[model samples]
Every structure is written in C-alpha cells, then in structure tokens.
Target: MPAEPLATVVGLLRDKFDLALPETSTELWHGHPVWLDDDLPVAGFKAYPTFVTVLFWRGQAITDHSGKLNASGSAEMSEYKLKSVDDFDSDLFDVWLQQVRELEAA
Candidate 1:
C-alpha cells in the first residue's frame, strides 16, 4: 500500500489506542508501536508492506464477537490486518482493547 494511506491507518489506530489505553505506556518495540501494561505487552501494531497488523498479546482470550481478529502464530496472540483506515472499526477495537487490558491485569 501507498505510504499516505498506510500512514492514515497507523494514525487512526494509534489515536484510538491512545484514547482507549490511557493507563498503558506506549513505546516502539522491535520497531513497531506497542502498548505495554506495566512493561508487559498488551497490544501493538506492526506496519507491513501490504497492511498494518494490529495485535493483541492475549487476543485468543478476548471474547471477540465481531470475529475480525485472526489467531496469530501458535500462542494466545491474535491480530487484525488493515489495508486502509476504513478497515478499522473503532467500536470493535475499543471492545478488544478493554478485554486485552483485563487479560493483562489478570
């Protein structure tokens, strides 16, 4: 994807994350933006050549009724790939973010 559209997607995701996870610290881990709860990664986003992948460290545990999150790797991680800003659903992301924070807390 083009840089402009990708930047827009990144901006949208980052904005929502900042709003939803005010208590978590934000940082660039392995070159990607990650939100950490007490130094443990709870959620993050990686920009790829084709899309931006939003990831939840304990995503498999989240009750994602929307079913947009796909299992990533062989762990509790889950992800949603966005090719554009329109692919992002703020409401769904907020729900998932809340669940992920809860998982991290536990």
Candidate 2:
C-alpha cells in the first residue's frame, strides 16, 4: 500500500484521470490501479516510495509535442513520474488522455 501522502496524490490524479475519460472504469491489475476503456487497458498508475508512475498503454503512438511523457522500456508504452500532487500537469495529462481515447476508439 502507499503512504498517506502518496495515497492522496494517487486519489487526486485518479479523480482527474477518471474525469477526463468518463467512459473508463477503474480496476486492479497486478495490484496496481488501472483504467480501462470498454475492457481494454488504456492507462494505469502505481505508487512508489519516492514517486508515482503513470503509464499510457499506447503512449508511444502519442504525439506529445510538450515532451512530458518519457520513453520507457517497451516500444508501445510511455510514462510520467510524479513526485507530488503539485507535479501533476493537468493540461498535458488531459491532452494525453484525449489522445489515448481517440486511439482506442480508432
């Protein structure tokens, strides 16, 4: 489980994420919080001792001109690290969220 502060951050981000994609539902996959669009995994969040990791399943396909999302291990995945609630970039995140929804719909 995450610490109190981290849990709060998780809650805040989760709420915003859910609001962005109102069609998505929350689920637990491998004990981490995952957001699914019509049963397809679209995004997920995992908390760590020092940071929280947010991932987009098809993030590599996103055209993130802001350069916020990091190129992670897989060729199809992209991620962002948030150390605190303040680090949560709502504008950039919303852009990515909309892109993911569009990609999934396509």
Against the hidden reference, what TM-scores do the models get?
Answer: 0.92, 0.89
**Candidate 1 structure quality by residue, lDDT tens digits, 1-106:** 3387888899988899999888999999988899998898889999987799999988899998988899999989999999887898888888898887677667
Which stretches of candidate 1 lie above 4 Å from their native place? none
Residue pair clashes in candidate 1? none
True-structure lDDT of candidate 2: 0.87
Of candidate 2, the 10-residue stretch with the lowest lDDT total is: 66-75
Q: Find the candidate with the highest TM-score and give its number.
A: 1
| Model 1 weakest 10-residue run by lDDT | 1-10
Residue runs of model 2 more than 4 Å from their true location after superposition: none
lDDT of 1: 0.88
Each candidate: RMSD to true structure? 1.6, 1.5
> Which candidate ranks first by lDDT, i.e. highest?
1
